[model samples]
Target chain A: MSRKKGFWRSSVWSLSLLAVLAGCGSNAASDSNGAAGGTATNAAGSDSEKEPVVLKLTTWNPISQTVVDKFQEKYPYITIEHDKVYDQFREIIRTRIVSKSDMDMLWLFPNQVAEFSKEDVLMDITGSPWLDNYLEAAVKLGTVDGKTYGVPYNSQPIVMFYNKTLFGELGLEIPQTWDELLAVSEQIKGSGTAPMVIGSKDGWATQFITTAQFGLYQHDNPDVFAQVASGEKKWTDPEFSTYFDGMKELADKGYLLENSVGLSYDQVAQVFKEGKAAMWPMGEWGYSENFDADFSAFELGAFPIPVNRGDQPLVTSLVSDNLLVGVSWSKHQEEIKLFMEFVADPEIAKIWSDETKQAVTVKGGTSETYSPLASSLQPLVDASEAQIFPSMTSSIEPVMFPIFQQILLKQDVDTSKLLEQLQAAQNKDI
Target chain B: MKFMNFRNYIMFILPALLIYLLFFAGPIFSGLYYGFTDWNGFSFKADWVGLENFREAFRDPLLLTALKNMLILSVVVIVLQHSFSILLAVLLDQKLKGIVWMRAVIFFPVILNTVVIGYVWSYMYAPMVGFLPKFFDAIGLHGLAALDWLGDPSLAIYAIALVMVWQYTGYSMMIYLAGLQSVSGEIYEAASIDGAGPWNKFWRVTLPLLIPSVIVNTVLSVIGCMKMFEHVFIMTQGGPANSTQTFGIMIYQYAFKTSQMGYGTAMAMILSVMILAVTYVQIKLLSRMEVAN
Candidate 1:
């Protein structure tokens, strides 16, 4: 009888706890509106009159945390809590957006910015005085339907990291053209180093390089994108054949790692860092480590990939480390503007650039004193002809990423098949 | 005399009946109702979609791949697992020394969480940087001869299946051991007096008595294998081109990832039908074997 009474008492307690939790949740939503309004009211105050407004930021780069900490010290009244989620960063941000939960600031890719900007979930920063400080291509990527959605910070373009030691042994200069690249591969193979360590396991690395190879069109033909977007030119055009044949040539010649199809980028990177390969095709993010690591003791040099017609020399890349800060449909306009002005500071960009060993997209933020690899990468930046938007963040991303994945798996994969799949996916949304 | 007491029997069964109705039957019937409507798991309203979600699931290639994986997994686990368990039980029943300790060792993997086991094995198969491949190299295998086990599509599913077999064989052994205990010692003694060989005695006497345990083990293994999710998910995430994906993974993709709750329910309904059909057939076959004996 006592045990039965105890069970009844425990059940009543659980029921009350559930009721209390439900009440707290509803109350918290109301409190959030008051808090956001209060923050807007106090934005113009002196350092002491302002209560600390702590905003939660989710970003990808490790260096962004350093940038946030420095920003916090300068403006003590505006505290920022930053967290980094590496693998599933996009998934977390997407979930929050769909749920209409809180997110004050976030980092976005070209595709993500394009998608969200279209959806009107971002603050329009275009025509602002600070917009003049950013690169034209970077600004264009952040703009969708005549409204700027994000402040572009850095850009990472695909470059070939060739072994200078192997080049010296084979008496070859760094390849200036695709023909020379293949020629150098044969020379390196004869000299006893693996020609290149291309890992296609995760599938994204292949897309980055292949997209770079196709960047020449943006400069040569301004109408190409408008045409492609309108579905005028097919993916099966002759240019695609050249790209597919080139990828197949590399695979057939065994220039890539034998187990690359089965290995991830991280594993392949270890092999490159360990000096088992002559060259690695990766972005500038790995530059600081390449220069500092004792194992990568050989001379490291980067060169812009050559176009088919070498004279045109068009270079393109996706925006890197872009911060897309927006007023939530729930936030007051004044609060978002103040936050945007704070993130746009040159000092913040400087601190971020120094820590991340990346270039700042803003004027007066690029530094020459960082390292040799960053200095040599100036041409790739200068050649920023275009930024091919990612499709996943937009209606197209879920469709495009998988189709591109199949293309990278084998060269024989038909381009027509991918185009058809995309057309079908677009029809579904319609 | 019995009719008056039978009134008391109704009182005895009433509490359990109420609990089952509340916990199991109520939710199951509710799920059937919700399965026909488009619900995102939250919201005061749900739109009815009729049989459209089910038709889409039937047409999806990913869902088809998942179904194939489930069938393959069920067959592999039910056959290989039962054979190994019975073999182990027979060896232990020979009255060997340290038999008590041996039984405990055999049952060790059965108690471990499948997620933990999957992760440990994946690291062990981590190709370039993993212990197994390094050990193989140390023992003198060179180049591509040292296989990348989990990364290769052809071998990835088998590696997961092998892990499942190792985990459940001990469980099946324990059930067989219990059944072995009930087989009269007098039958074995009588077989020996009739000059029956050891193999003959196992086939004629022991095998007949172990039939019931076989049925139980098969049903359990099949049901468990058909619902296999956590281990394969943690280890592979259906990589190397969706080679290890199961029906449960597909259901999760529709429900949470894609936010298609109604479609997920439709898939779950199909799964229920498949499980029921497969189980009914097995039980019927097992009963027929018992009747023949």
Candidate 2:
């Protein structure tokens, strides 16, 4: 063959192969895109007669699969496809809009709802029947500009989880004073168990400590948010430094699990679960998971994270559960409302409360079906003293985590300089 | 092969050229445009604010901090990675007993995924049950061991850069080995007859002959360090006060986490320009060296 003809023939073959490969990709995408505009309604309806509707719900929380199964059972016409996007929930759901994706529902916590609300991405579930059943705090979180956008699921109070067996063995009571807590930690460290397990490697886990510690001073100063808004209260204050100082003290005394910086949240949980550490600092959200584990000799208990002295008011930080947001762009609003209504039913809410080991906002959600660890904090939560977590999640978390890591690692960190840097980091306009 | 008609030539190259333009140039220009807007990533309705995002990025202290960290990572990685690779390539060029074992051992980390390598080093550098601290104390070198390899701001960048060096040195050694083998045996024989010793021959002959490989390896290492993110993300997360943060991590943080699409795009433009400038200089310098030698 002539050179020109050979080149032409080869190019055609190569281009054809590329075309075929590209076709395959497009075909696969369209097949998976069959998640919307398929909700069937029974206009000639009786109580039990309806066609099946597929609703896709994306979540970051590791929701129990059985809750979804039960929902499907109640509305036999509805099939819920649950996608656990994990840490990428926000990015994925947000981008789903660009693709004109068929996502119906999503779970968002705290700031995410507010962020998404700015874009008008979520449906305004105003006067949603489920709203009345929810706690006012949860309703407020999911609301922006007087319109409700989400339904609250469960709320968890962050606390210090202790091994009762270990505490009893060391002849220690739950220390109500910072000095007593230090002494207890010292004694525990001397006995060879690491006083606490806090994994700073993930950086986000350090916020658990910050939020919990901030609770020590939160009850007396419930209006700290106003101070923060007015720029009157800086994280570098001596009062705040006491928390950092406590972390430094733990690191200096080798009371922290020596390699906690390298461990992840789950790894530290395991260390505490295996009775290698005296306490695990975390929220009650993990109560069911941790308590279900093989702790042969010990029972899990919790207490308020102490502040300074015994006389000072003791408190804990309660972080409400993230709200379930409905996508405004979805074609399945009926199915979305149906699923949420099922969730708000008292029996179903109680089941969610039991499974998540967190207090549900449904009026009769708290029916005393909590694990011993969660029950310990229920009274404090009911008393309304457990204020919202004071730590700044957005502006401060990125910079503060590192400073907290250094303090907990016994490094010579200048809180003054670091807090200044954090303030500078927050000062950047997006 | 034969020459084609001009129309056929255009048709043949059109597919590949269009693919390149559609994927590569399209995104680059789009990102440049996004840099001038106030986009929150989630919203496509961007309010165009001319140069505001760039100005904000310029004033941001963390960007400067991350830029400094990227430079240090690039310098340290380029030096150690190339030196160690060259030494290994030269030594392994000599056929000795157990050469396969030594090469395999050195190249083992190269085959492992970077995520695995990062996690392994994290565990090794951990204060408890970590190999470094315990091994150091065992060898009476306790001062050299750190309790938290990633928690110390002063040491975190260097520590992460060294991990990159450890992982890629073997790959560079393989490239240098290929370059070394291409040099004829006659050149070394001629050097020996001229009364040149091994050290002198290496500096005079082996080094000069390996210019092509040096250029390739240096370019790769420079690009790798300039965009270093995964290791920092997996290990320190640019922490102990963002000491180990890099340009790539900053782009991801602003774009994805912070939802500041315009700010991230501005930083991304800066990083792309910086990479382009560095690569251009490197090509120019290497071409000069190639011509000089």
Candidate 3:
């Protein structure tokens, strides 16, 4: 009995020590990785004899692995390691950063620029030479407090994607106002086609419509949010009331797709691209991403969401999707900077543009099959008729997003109460 | 022998003690401590914010709604999932044609991964090309055709719950089957000799004997449904107007999306206490269900 107890005690101590050792061993491995990465990467600055370096990049979205290989070929010493973390990127990445994980770079949404830049987590790269290569608006998105913490990757806009062939067949012109848009939807429904194709099953998809209005009105009244903040203007006031009323009118008249709430985004896009729907309200990238020649023989065009303000320039909702950010305390800042410069290169930007069918923010980057409707998108930006949405009040969006879905679910919702909730949430965040 | 008894007990428990200290106790205590601080999930550090996060949570309409949802899921799953599972298990226990196949079919969904089940159900619940709407339409139920299973707030949570029931009913059934098998066949023979009907035999003999299974199933489902995340995360993501929001989803939303780590941890701590209290109450209440075999 004494021998057996002794053996068990010995085993317990040894096993626990082994677990401790295993944890320490992992830390040691990462330390070694950080060391190797630092030396070879910093050596790149002098452009002299160098050793192999690994640059770790974490992204929530897919970027072609081949693109990393291409970058490696250009800089033989630096090896690019990409980690694709989906669904739980925010949680995982925040934890990683806090635990001092040695990731060289990461992708971020535009709204995160301010959140991260406020901390020591993100390195300031305001002087990156490649910043000049991107459009001013795109560059502006990666800036917080006049400091550039990220480099712009891509921009997309929410718009009305209409089938040109179907429009011609129905003798319909692009609607200039909210009433016209609804009248056209009713007409399209009368002609036995789904009028407006949307998938409200995903609340985010429904918010595209709401977000579009938010953007359009911001272009007209930039102080609207400030007014609400000061309690001088309610959301039930003209700015939002008109938008909500127009939306409710559409729902009341059955101008929406018959089974919109049951369809997924991809499925509804498929229906619209196949010319089964008269108008598909989607992101500008929809034409490039969702249009399949096998499903339709029609040409597609785009227009902005009409705010029904006669003679006011129509505001298109534009948003910068991906911004490349670097860790502030990385030893290989030079190497991280080099990688960002390469990604901002028009050649690399063009490759991303061609693959994802999304617009690259780099000025010289161009895709072969760019839509003519998207061609004048720059002029709209210059005219101040383009608004970067979801960024207007990103602090409040987390609280308001669910309410947006609720408004869609119950059309008769009291807008005053909803605005009060918004006001309360905004105050709490403040 | 007396001298070695102390050593033997210590040796036996040391490994488990170490594991419990490192994994379970470490996280729970750390989370509880952080609940008093204002940690923004990431950054330099946290500051003390005692009782503030808890106060905020109590006032939060969304969190309250999520708590309500947790209770609804708990009650529905405990009652419906276990009773239905026991009934099916009893029927399957009888020697019938294709009994093995029926058991296999019922238990098959349990073995499949949550993601596969979630995605498959998501497609089935979809309209037009999906199965549910088509079946309803074929049956001449025009109103039921194209029912927005996951979209309408009034119906979305129940729809999600039905999927949960489908996935877990087999699990409870297997437990009941095991309990049913444990009962002596001689007892049934004795009941037959007493001139008892099938229903009477089941009620008087089988039910009392099956109390253990009922207790386990009820406890398991109550806790499982309270911690429900995967299917709800994949299917609706607590959407179609926050109708399907649960404490688990709220924790993720606050911790990650909103980046309020301290508050999220506080919410998690509150949720842990709630689960503990509920489970204890449940076990005590369900202990009355057990009968001496």
Q: List the candidates' TM-scores in order.
A: 0.79, 0.84, 0.89
Best by TM-score: 3
| Candidate 1 lDDT for residue B181 | 89
- Model 1, range B89-196, lDDT digits (tens) per residue? 988886888999999999999889887897777667666666677887887876633676666666767778878898899999999999998999999999999999
Model-by-model DockQ, in order: 0.21, 0.28, 0.52
- Give the Å error, residue A338, model 2: 0.7
| lDDT (Cα, tens digit) per residue for candidate 3, span A50-133 | 656688889876775666878888788788888889766766877777666768789877656667777767878987788999
Q: Count the clashes in each prediction.
A: 2, 2, 0
Kindly list the per-residue Cα lDDT of model 2 for residues A224-276, writing each as its tens digit. 64355346766556665555666666677787876466566665676677777
Off by over 4 Å in 2: A1-51, A98-100, A177-197, A213-263, A270-277, A285-292, A296-300, A308-313, A355-359, A366-372, A375-384, A388-393, A409-430, B1-4, B94-105, B134-146
- Backbone clash total, candidate 3: 0
Q: Which ten residues in a row have the lowest lDDT in candidate 3 chain B?
A: B284-293
| Tens-digit lDDT track of model 1 for A1-430 | 6745755675576556555744543543454446556656767668688766667666776656676666667677767767676765655666565445666666776656654565556666778777776666666667767778776677566677777776787798866567778888888877777887765445455455455665666665654654455556544455444544555566668676555444556666666766778888777665664455555467767766544445655464543546556644434444455555655676666666776777776666766644467666676556545454333323343345444434434545655566566555544322
The 10 consecutive residues of candidate 2 chain B with the worst lDDT sum are B1-10
Give the TM-score (0 to 1) of chain B in model 1: 0.90
Model 3 CA deviation exceeding 4 Å by range:
A1-41, A44-48, A64-67, A217-246, A270-276, A297-299, A370-384, A390-395, B1-16, B95-98
